[model samples]
Target: MQRAVIPLKGELTVGDDYTAGDFFDSVSFRGVQLASDDNMLPDSLKGFAPVVRGIAKSNAQITIKQNGYTIYQTYVSPGAFEISDIYSTSSSGDLLVEIKEADGSVNSYSVPFSSVPLLQRQGRIKYAVTLAKYRTNSNEQQESKFAQATLQWGGPWGTTWYGGGQYAEYYRAAMFGLGFNLGDFGAISFDVTQAKSTLADQSEHKGQSYRFLYAKTLNQLGTNFQLMGYRYSTSGFYTLSDTMYKHMDGYEFNDGDDEDTPMWSRYYNLFYTKRGKLQVNISQQLSEYGSFYLSGSQQTYWHTDQQDRLLQFGYNTQIKDLSLGISWNYSKSRGQPDADQVFALNFSLPLNLLLSRSNDSYTSKKNYAWMTSNTSIDNEGHTTQNLGLTETLLDDGNLSYSVQQGYNSEGKTANGSASMDYKGVFADARVGYNYSDNGSQQQLNYALSGSLVAHSQGITLGQSLGETNVLIAAPGAENTRVANSTGLKTDWRGYTVVPYATSYRENRIALDAASLKRNVDLENAVVNVVPTKGALVLAEFNAHAGARVLMKTSKQGISLRFGAIATLDGVQTNSGIIDDDGSLYMAGLPAKGTITVRWGEAPDQICHISYELTEQQINSAITRMDAICR
Candidate 1:
């Protein structure tokens, strides 16, 4: 539809005058041109209205046509006019349109655009590769040099890349990596590497190092089990334990200097875990917590961090309102500080039974450790026994409480602490005193803790009123409604109809009885003063109708409630934020899916209601409702 402007200041302008036979004209309408994509011309504006050029009066006459056939023709004068209308086309071709003056004169000033829009497509290839290597001479004996190359790519099949290095002496090496993704079925990956001396000795040249890692996730079983298996060994394979040293676990290994000697460190491991409401993990290290006798000269050593005898078992489960877990860690440090020499246990259960009006998170725990310390010559015992509870204050969201108490022999004897988080306020206080009996000398134990934290969530002030859904009855109104003490009215004239409020403070907009101008079929008519490139938006139209549907949206996209309230047991809250209008240019919602909505709190507001949707939503909501394209 074409439209011209009638600038009548205080009188209040409503609709366009339907007097001219042309829908759009080059005269009378000042400062009008082709609307940009940003304008998002409405369907109502494209039909039957003459191209109301900036120079033409909107009250001029115009005719909208389809397939060279007139669909709507009318002479709009000063009374009322629909600037835009809903436009739909069944045929596929370039649409040719023209604009003329109300006097049936051709307006060469405005020209329409011609283009074909394509559907959004996934699976487009876009990737980048980087490879670099350099070596500097230090000892110079072997004229050291290194080189490597790598490339990564893939989409549905996942990605794979491998790189290897070698010295000039023919010492060849190879590493392989593979990743396979089966979509919702799960994923599998493998990494393996082996290197050996190019020159072979009579018995055996340099030691050959080898490593293998395999991991897979089983999502089909609904368990989402992640099973991982790894084996690493660097042995000359010439003798029992020649030169074998590696960081015991994935705990960031540190060999430090070459002066340190690693007799041999080889291990095989298996880890399986499933994460859900409860988390479970079971793993084993082939050589954890095991002692070795060299030439019958026995030397006791424990892993500083489970690097010794490598078998491990771990599991955790949560049922109903209770959650508990157990883990077994065993590793034998051949000669290093033997930290793997001890076994520990723990248990967690609700502690509210001993407390009053406590939340379900109340928990009690006990841990016991029987092992040797790194510097201790003789076997010592260390155990940490603790009891604690946590709960939320019912009425005061700012108030939460927790307490912890611990006891042990080879460790501190007494310890206790408590803390709370209130609104943006946080505070914690703790102190500990210990009593110890040592074999060689008496030791002192003490503990102290203090914490302060504060922060506030952000805030946004925005709102809209009766988005053309219902006709408001105020005095001077144009395309939309009015709500003064008098009653509801539509297409009102002879009164004052202007924009709701011309400005706002602190990003808040309101449509007072006077400060808004709208047209028929105009809903959610947002005026985004913030002209960023893009923005997200949320619009809601609620009544005693269907669901309290919410719309996560922007200028380009929108989300609606199909069975939202029903799926949510009929209770819903329309809360959250949206980007400003016009800024959201995305054709669809990102990976997190489109907006979400649900029924409102009231009973009568639980039915289907049409809405003024953003273009982006039309693409995303279909992925779920109409699975054919997905």
Candidate 2:
């Protein structure tokens, strides 16, 4: 993500050194941070996002509003379209969508939206405020400045009160809601929004929308209602996005219109107004038999006999080393005469389960391989079947490959595909190829992904970065593998990056002691850090590099007493205590060095000894030597 920093009450200035790239998906002003209440958290932690589905009769402009605030708006071509990237404004409000066609007609619909329980601890409050220009993905639409704000407070009696508002030049809206934590009964919220919009055509519209959301989990019965909700709206409602461009220029068709116009273009004038919508999502556990889930949504419109619907059901189970799953999907668009349906079945088994235990090597390889099969039948009764074998290679399982062969009964064609993936220390890569016998068609594709970190110490390459990361600094410890990471290690400079560190949480980073060289020793092997969002924290390890030695020494023809202290003249960490046999064991030592031995403060009790190690001995795990203190 990229953001422009704009001062709210001071002059804004920028430096001459500016850079730009296409690495980010979106851009906004820094002051707009309040627009996303959960900006500090990664997308994965934000929980489920609602998906809005619609059927556009013609080239149209789509607008999505939640709790009276416009969240997303864009242009789409005629056909069935699903908007799954909407950044939700709240956890429990329903979404209102308006489709404005090229011929000046409009269709409105509602999408139920909710998340996990919206209960908050007592006496807690959360709020946000945003002031910025209205932004959209459509280039032809005019922009407007707007302000939005929201507040949520935990009240007495296990209740919560939440409200928010949006204001623009020609549009204004407000919403209020109350949520209840019913203890063992579950959690529920009810909200209502009022909106007023003045169109470019000097027309004013006002309407009200009501929404209800509920979430519950029954641990004993193994049932979870992730989200269930319903919403209803009046016919005169108009969102900020709708009012701004309602009367803007639109395409018109005539007898002299271009002959190349698509078939859907002629129906651009049809309009359907939304009335009510219902959404449900539930999952159940079947103990040892497996689990199943059902999710679906339905929408009804005013002044129209047609309704839009989507439903899905799935079940999964496992027996010993075998896994099985069955699923079905159904969908019907508003203006379509026929609905689409599909059913699928899939299963997988470990290849090693059928192998004999006699051949250890072969059996070990088979343990990483699995046989899988899938069959599906679509609405048109076309059946397709595929069988595949997938296996993980390499001792670390960083490399994996899959091969599949399939048949489609509709075309009586045989198809095959192969894919390979490699997760290396520096990057991740994938390559795939597919071919069909029907038309001798073939296609190939490949991708490479990784991240780079630049610090004062130097630059290092690593696996794909996450929202937070840690830079490992262990000087002189080259090629030392990191613990608990796939194919990750320090570079020649003893510097590497640990990507995907969790923000606002303690993360433990450790080096693989077993992978270290004998000449290198780590003063500390593990480090813990709690990083903030988008931070690259530093983890430092003190590493000493040299030879390890175990030398037997004597002072003036007499063995040095036990408990005597020995230290190398030039090495800071090369120190040891003499053992009973007068053997001193020390690491991080040079090939040739002078040692000092002291058993007491008396003048004759201390002595100096000189030692030199052969090349072979210097390279050994533990060099052994004999020295005499002069």
Estimate the TM-score of every prediction: 0.31, 0.77
lDDT per residue as tens, model 2, 461-528: 98899767999999878899899887789999899889989765788999988888878878789999
lDDT of residue 571 for candidate 2: 62
Query: Each model's RMSD to truth, in Å?
Result: 31.9, 8.4
lDDT of 2 at 439: 34
Candidate 1 Cα misplacement greater than 4 A, ranges: 1-149, 155-174, 177-211, 216-225, 232-307, 317-320, 337-382, 392-401, 420-630
Q: Which stretches of candidate 2 lie over 4 Å from their true place?
A: 1-31, 35-113, 200-202, 244-271, 353-367, 550-585, 594-611, 624-630
> Mind giving the per-residue lDDT tens digits that candidate 1 earns over 1-630?
232221210111122211111111111111112211211223322212212111111123455433223344544321112234423221221122223422233321111211111101133221111121211121111222332222223434354333333322334445455455545544444444445443222222343323222333444323323332333334321111111212112121123324233222212111110010111222322232321111000111122223223333434454543443343333333333543323333344653454533533433312111211111111355454445555554332324555544444443444434454332211222332222222222223332322211112122211122111111222223323233311122233212111222111112222233334321112232223421112222222121111122333321133322333212112232222223321111221222333322346665433332243434544332321211100
Best by TM-score: 2
Question: lDDT per model, in order?
Answer: 0.27, 0.69
CA shift of 383, model 2, Å: 1.2
Model 2 compared with the native: what TM-score? 0.77
